[model samples]
Target: MPTGLVALLDDVAAIAKVAAASLDDIGVAAARAGTKSAGVVIDDAAVTPQYVTGFHPSRELPMIWKIAKGSFKNKLIFLLPAAVLLGQFAPFLIPIILILGGLFLCYEAAEKVLEWLHVDETTKHDEPAIVEGHGREEEMVSGAIRTDLILSAEIMAIALSEITDEVWWQQGIILAVIGIVITVGVYGAVALIVKMDDVGLHLATENEGVVAAFGRGLVAFMPKLLTTLSIVGTLAMAWVGGGLLVHNIAAVGWHGPEHLIEIISHPLLGLFPESAEMTVGGIAFALLSGILGVLVGAGIAPLVHRFFPHGAEANE
Candidate 1:
């Protein structure tokens, strides 16, 4: 009986080892693949702040909670299945969809710029109307979900492209990981950001010297921080959105932009030293892509707003 038990233990140990290895593989692949979606992920985090900016202090946390839940639904429930289906049924369609998403991002960013400068001569739309009444919460929640769908779709597509070596199950799991990780990270940061002022006020009133000083500083800094974040988010949206469209355009058979980038790189390569040259090329192309993307976005914004006022122009 003792000998038999020892053998069984050894067998269990071997199986456990295999299971652990498989899990490690999944973790590594997920991390690698998710990192590729960095651009969209940055844009997502940046854009999310605008959604939570206008609510009352008491309602802010609840509002963020509502949007965060909606974001999860967008990613896991809707996008995960759709991403798998796209990987299976119409692999070719993915690029097309991503390109369109990229365009939308660009348009949204450009519109934000236009609004900030008050160039369009429209009323203040940087903030959406607050829904009130019995149905108001539901309306706000639904609107958040609708907004999240667009952002989540962009995130998933970028993540999907990131998973180069995975089969369907592998890709699906990586995307799920990315979605959950990013959603939690974004909302968690947002919650902390929104509440800082309150936290600061409480601290400032406290008897403790250090805490009070920090609180005072936070109260002074909150507005500046939010303003900076808004600026960064808009710029990120333009650059990422433009980058996605340009890359996808090449993938879908337009060699013009890609070729032009290469040609531009060659000149920089001759002008710069070895290691720095590569970085120069990349930065230049990214700038080129961003500038072109803004132009493209500006051009398409009017048509899009006319046809689908809620498209990228949801403004909320």
Candidate 2:
């Protein structure tokens, strides 16, 4: 009996070691994959609040909760299995799909820029009526969840493509971890962001000292921060999408666009001819990619509009 007990302990130790190693592997992959999809993460974080805008203060947290739950479903049930199959069968197709996702990101960024420039502000969806229906909260939550599914699809695809060499289960776990971490991080941030005013209002009304003054400042800063995040998110989306497009095009066959851009920026490198040889390539590449991204994005928007006239309604 003692010998049997020792064998059992030995087996348990081995299993524990394997589990620990698997977790470590998942952590490393998650970090690497998360980094690759950081741009979409920012865009996710940025765009989520727009969904919560005009909601009752009490409903904001609940709405975010509903979206977060849907986001988990997107990762676990849909994206995870799809990624596994893509990896197992049509590995080549992953990049093509990722490129398309990147193009979508670019289009969104360009649309934001156009709106910023007041070129087509009317095209941007105005906040729907804030008034609550009999079951408006459910409707809003459902809509937000559907939106998260699209963005989460992009995030998962990007992350899955980044996994270098791992088993299918390993990749799935890493992707799952990324989905949860990013969703929680983003929506958690959203909750804090959307509630700053409420928090400030409470603080200001309740506290009667320097605390009150700070609360007022918090209330004031929140709007500016939200605007800045939205603008930065737009640019990041464009830049990342453009970079992906350029690389994917090169990956396939045609490097014409990328090469042409490099040639265009080859002249404006730097004053120092010596340093220009080194850093000029990178700087030039980034600039050209960004410009191309904006152009590509702008081009796609009209096609999207032609297909889906009422963007808000279509999305709903």
Candidate 3:
């Protein structure tokens, strides 16, 4: 009996060790996947604030909560399963889907640019009015969720692509963890950002000295910050999307865009010290990719608009 009990304890200990190692693997994989999707995460963090702008301060958090819930649904209920099944059953389709998603991102970014330049007629109308009346909140939440779905799909796909050697269930778990972490991080940041002005106002009016000055600074800086984030988000979407297309094409033996990046980056390589060379090259590559993405998007926009005017804005 004593020997048998010892054997059972040893078996339990072994099981515990295996469980721990599996968890560690999942953590490392999740981090890698999350980092791979960072560009989209930034774009998401930047995109969400626009939804809350001009709303009543009281409604801001609630609206964000609603959006967060929708985002969770988008990732966990819809995207996660789809991504897992795609990887399991039809791996060849992965590249095609990624390319299509990248093109969609490019198209969305280009459409925004057109609107900014007044070349798109949709920019002329006022954004849907912010009202406390019935259905207004639902309209805003629904719109935000629709946009989140694409971004969430991209995030999950990017995450899924990075995970190798894991079983389908393991990959799904890693993706699920990633989805949850990103949604929390993005929405939490958005909540803090949209309310900073209110915080600043309170500090400015209710306090004094450095606190007041800081508050004043926060209030003044937010608009410029939002504007900058908007531009960055657009550029990031283009760069990431363009890079995806370029790399995937290279994977299949066409290397034009890849070679162009190396060519563009090569000259500057010698300009920087060895340590900074990689950084410089990366920037050069990203810049070229972004430019290409914008051009591709712009070229496609007219065709998309002619046939699918309504779909264009939704994709954007």
Among these predictions, the greatest lDDT belongs to 3
Q: How does candidate 2 score on lDDT?
A: 0.82
Ranking by TM-score: 3, 2, 1
Q: How many backbone clashes does candidate 1 have?
A: 0
Off by over 4 Å in 2: 1-22, 125-129, 264-284, 312-316
Q: Each candidate's lDDT (Cα)? A: 0.78, 0.82, 0.86
Candidate ordering by lDDT (highest first): 3, 2, 1
lDDT per residue as tens, model 2, 149-177:
88898888888878837888888788888
Please, what are the lDDT tens digits per residue for candidate 1 over residues 1-316? 9999999999999999988887788898778767656666666666665665555677878888988998998899999999988887787887798799888888877777777878754325545565445366556657767877888898888777766456788778878888999889888988888899989998999747887899999999988987887777777778778888878888899978778767766776788888797788878877777777777888987887678765444554
Task: Tell me the TM-score of model 3.
Answer: 0.91
- Candidate 1 vs candidate 3: which has greater TM-score? 3
Query: What does candidate 1 score on TM?
Result: 0.86
Runs in model 3 lying further than 4 Å from the true structure: 114-129, 208-210, 273-276, 314-316
For candidate 3, lDDT tens digit of each residue in 121-182?
Answer: 65345664656843877877898999999899999887887884688988999999999999
Error of 1 at 240 (Å): 1.7
Cα-based lDDT at residue 289, candidate 2: 77
- What residue pairs are clashing in model 1? none
